[model samples]
Target: MVGYSALMERAEEATYAGFERLKRDLIEPSLSRHEGRLIKTTGDGALAEFASPLAAVRCAVEIQDGLISGRHGFKMRIGINLGDVIVGTDGELFGDGINIAVRLEGLADQGGILISEKVLNEVEGKLDVGFEDRGEQQLKNIARPVRAYAVRSGADSPLTERIGVAPALPDKLSIAVLPFQNMSGDPEQEYFADGMVEEITTALSRFKWLFVIARNSSFTFKGKAIDIKDVGRRLGVRYVLEGSVRKASGKVRIAGQLIDAVTDAHVWADTFERDLSDIFLLQDEITTAVVGAILPKMLRAQIVTATRRRPENLTAYDLQLRAMYQYSLATRKGLAEAIRLANRALELDPRFGFVAALASLFHMVKVILGFATDPQFDRKEAIRFLRWASSVDDGDPQTLATTAMVSAFMVGDYESSIEMIDRAVALNPNSHWVWLDRGWVYHTAGVPEEAIRSFELAMRMSPLDPMLDRLCVGMGMALIELSRFDEAIAAGKKALRHNPSFSATYWCLASAFAHLGRGAEAREAAARLLELDPAFTISAWIARGGQSNAQLAIEGLRKAGLPE
Candidate 1:
């Protein structure tokens, strides 16, 4: 029934007569053969009911084959669902069952049959045809998402071959954003919808932590009814984003939703309506909002997935995730465990630049937190691992960012560290970690204002990040340098809330309190710092390099009566 309107527009008398003959000769007889009760008929299509789901599906396939083989000028799209139906006195069907099937037909491709999950389950092995899982779809007017399947005519279809094998997902978060449907009805508005998708894809690509499918790969499914699970398999992604764009009456509406392709779970969804005054500005605004909203959700999803994985089945990437979680705790025991996991990951993948850089950063943390059993050995190993990570993959933004922080703090090479961090940010501007590294590098290079700006940008990008304490501590350091002692104290306390064992937060709090002439509070802060790091001393901290840029903090430590 797909092209009925077109046929009517061009039909002659002979064409109309032939169509009548087709219905009388082929369609009616097939319904009778399958024991289908014809309920009603419209100009373009008919509604029929059968006692068996299997009979209904077989009848659909037979009619489709007959239409194609008999050289009929048009094709039909069919949808089947199995559910309770309410029949009216006029023999009309009224209920969700009928509504869902109708919506599925609208979503179906020309000449194809779509079936609900219930129908699929009942007729799967009994039918000769194959079923392709279309994943969970939000049918028009449906209260909940429904899983649908596309029916293939033969056993030799590609879907049958792919039943047991699909591409493995990448270690990091991955997504594919399909081209949005143009709901404006005006064909000319296609370009606007496509541009919106492209803008979103490009913006998401800037996040170093995410693996985004290329635009060309994603656009292949445009204008076709697709299964989200199939698209995820073909693209090797974990999530899929799809939506619609409508432009009318001097305004535009865009609706998008993210789905976990593996589980068909709705991860996030939102809608934006705006005046179409500035199209490019509108695109930018939507892209930023979409990226900012989905990132934290995706990260949380990834963490949950990784946590559920068995320890023995851990991949190099899974080990890296575990290491990251441990590092977020910011305690001596946590750093030790994180280092161990990073080393295990390195053993599995010798050239893993991210984990190698993490190992180097963990060693540097030991010296900074006064947790190193042998400071000299830890410093040497930190530099050695940093060199190895750069040699393996200097272009990786995370590696470069971590290397820059180590260079600034441990080696006191401010100029080179700043250059490296700037390049990392330029490479992946959306990466919060890169911005966080920029904050620390600028702070140690004697630019407190720029450091504050960088830290603030990082916080804005990933507000729910587990490592948010790092950002808070960086901001506190910059505030102290600017003589904003009260703000520094507040920032330090916030950092403590995030990770109370972090020695840097105590250092910041103790210095800020002393600068504000709160002698008792400063002494209490210093006592807590001593408890965390029994070996901490004014002389030891100054000797760790980068102390020249922290003269104010060092003076405050002296005023607080810490051992020199």
Candidate 2:
């Protein structure tokens, strides 16, 4: 009951119904088979009494193991206690044992089980599941302190279930630099001013430790005034950088604000009016000033991120900037042309960090989505380009990240891929692609929170990027993993707005709708997905990027009519 609010706040009635079915089929049977009496079940934790403490622990372990076999984040905690009880007249039970059970349940990790010392002594070595001693725990309102131990359900290790990620904790400082609005009196000058912001954003992105929001996703809110907190909530960022450029008389007036999006407070604000010739220097000054101002104010823990990496050279970055213009236009021909330009740049300078990495990325896409007649060729090209680029400046952040991304999908070296992405991101703080690829890496690694951060950052990097449909779909999957179905649905709809033809959005919509018990909408979305990609199936879901994410995505679509 302690976390019932959070569960109900996140999960839908249908999700609880699924859990109820699970309880009826597996949990109730296993409990009865072991002679355990059902007390009551809350949203995420359950209570039951057993004639023997050993039976209680055994039933708890079995229930956990069974629930985890399925996907969809419908998980719970279990607590077992052995002590005297007082039964109430209204078919309810009460006692110190009941309180102890509730207390121990509160202490159990998600998808984990905990037992009092009394229950532990009886259950020792009786069950096949593993156990870890969390040591004695003291709780208020209970007469005496209690001793508790954690029980692992076999699939998840005791260490993984309990240990938290250091980088993504709430204490970590993060910022999103939104696309600077174009307020030049001349409409034709929009691109010029935006180009300036993009360059500034690109330059700023080279810092690995600072959490720079993706330009494409952040610029999605451009041209419209907005609430800062809403931006924070949607993007899950702590700080926001907003500015507008007004160009006139061969000069530009640029105003920027570093707002604490969470509190809607302006931490820093400055406006620079300069001649067009001073554009490059102005951009550099802005990047340095913002970075300098923010660094000292950052929390001490963030000062030492897990990794440090960066690319030493910027020569190839020029090619990337030009290619980005064509990519942003995003016509099939335009993207293809952009790839050609990037490839030529790679040919001229094989070790050009960003160009070679992106050239490999283009081929990697050709392999994944079947843009190339020979996927094997595309994959081989990706590996070759990455290998050559890695040899040139292995210390380059973009190089490591691009190599990692290709390796994760093509080579299946998940750990090395992530380690490389970490190194690359450390080197180039403003590399949106690195962050996006890193998110994909986490999704593949089955770490949902980190995945969400990566996608969110991706959105910030390319606010107008035509490719955001996939990023949004991926972000939705991450939310679903964390059991935020409503938010997941919201993200899916955002994806649909950008690219109506995106098959993944249809899948996300189908999953979110089904998980929420919106049967009609779910069916419609699933139908649309089948229409777009007839080969789409649970198998297809698994073959894509994330296994655990795909499993739940399959559950959602399968329930909506697409077969397993």
Candidate 3:
């Protein structure tokens, strides 16, 4: 009966049929099971009579839960009241309870259940569900005001349910950084405050272990005071960060506070004051401080949660966490264990696209690190797993970016790879993975400048990213292609400091040093590369495929005494 007027007038014929089918197949069965009898049916809703108020409320809950959780194509608002009523001989019920229920239903949100005080008093402590007291409301034609209570069904309540998708809270720590208020009383500094939040959000997202909502979604609440619990529920996040920035008399001050939104408990608060000598550097310093402060807190929180989870009840996400931890070890034994964990995760839930993509990336890593017994076979498996991941959820930027880069590197399908990665970037412009992966794709597609830009963007987005070595290596490769030998060598040296075992970084150093005519350094780097992968050769590089700009790298490698 709620919003039924527009439903009847605006809905198509099939919509009406679907509604009818919902009532026939779902509502009627639920009512029958609850021992409620349908007295009459209206175009949009129905009237029913139960033997007791408890039965009536339970039946209402069942019907509403069914319609809301099931694929009924529509949702309904339900109301129940417990009161004496007149039963006509024809079986139609006539009473103030019926009228009040109808009126309460109209007041309820779609897919909600509202009951009067009498019904709540009767059902209290009997059912597993709780009620949200909505306070007393004056009803039309009713002698007295009725106290209304909305049923609170855990996990299935209207407040929690989204359309066709359940809320996916982060398996690890999740946080949202709301836009910083500009308290300077100057409108021009608004961008500074907004940039501060964006930087923090971007920095946090790079943790890989933390789930940070994108700036676009978090900024929606800008300039609005909100309840932390409401924010947690709305965003499916457990923590929230809010702050303000003020700039006056050439001094910049930024203050931020992180809160456990669930319990409304303050986790941390800090303020930084510095002369605005260089605005960008000041922002960078603030970003580093915030990221540094939050990471340890989030890690402690994660450790506490992990300690609490029973081993037997480990979820696929838990397996993923284990897998990523092993992957981060970046050794042969670690890679093997990572693969094992990923396989176990797949066994538990094969439909998880993120896990599938992760497994695919593991294989890709095997190919790159020379860990596979048969590189071609591993390449094929990587492609197959990436395809599987895409089939599950192509919209996920992580999946798309990883899959796309794997396609480019393993299959040499740079055009299709770039297309997929572009889509990922479009889906989430703030995702560092998209930028990083697209850098590789663009480099292989013969666009060194574009590749460089993408890599720089990745660095900006995640200054402390665990994958910063990869970004440095990628930028070095692109710089080498541009014949910037010294710059490439510097980048390669930086990359080596982070991940000395990475063969690509050594290869970059060798090539750049050779091109710069530094024979001793070039030979030393080439020797290190051969130590890591003695079978590495120019022939394999040619077989792997590259763009026109790749000739510079090939020539430099040849000069560095690499095998052809």
TM for every model, in the order presented, reads 0.66, 0.44, 0.61
RMSD (CA, Å), each prediction: 19.4, 23.8, 14.1
Model 3, 216-303: lDDT tens digits are: 4566688888898888777778889999899999999989898988789887787889999998988877886777666555555554
The CA lDDT at 76 in model 1 is 83
What overall lDDT, based on C-alpha atoms, would model 1 receive against the true structure?
A: 0.83
Model 1 misplaced regions, further than 4 Å: 1-165, 181-190, 206-209, 220-230, 243-256, 269-289
* The candidate that achieves the highest lDDT relative to the unseen native structure: 1
Model 1 per-residue lDDT at 527: 94
User: What is the Å distance of residue 232 in model 2 from its true position?
Assistant: 34
Model 1 lDDT-worst window of ten:
156-165
Predicted structure 3: lDDT: 0.77
What C-alpha lDDT values do all the predictions have?
A: 0.83, 0.66, 0.77
lDDT per residue, candidate 1, 1-564, as tens digits?
876767777875656676776675456655644546677887778888876798688668767766665656767899999999998977678899999988888888787889999999898776545778899989988999999999985543332223223556767889989999999999999999999997887767655456776565577799898988888887779999999999999999999999998888899998989999999989977786677667777877887787789999898878888887778777788889999999999999887787889999999988888778888998988898899888665766778999999999888899999999999988767677888999999999999999999998888777777777889988998999999999999999999888887888888999999999999999999999898888889999977666679888988998888889
Ranking by TM-score: 1, 3, 2
TM-score between candidate 3 and the true structure: 0.61
Report the candidate with higher lDDT, 1 versus 2: 1
Instruction: Order candidates by lDDT, high to low.
Output: 1, 3, 2
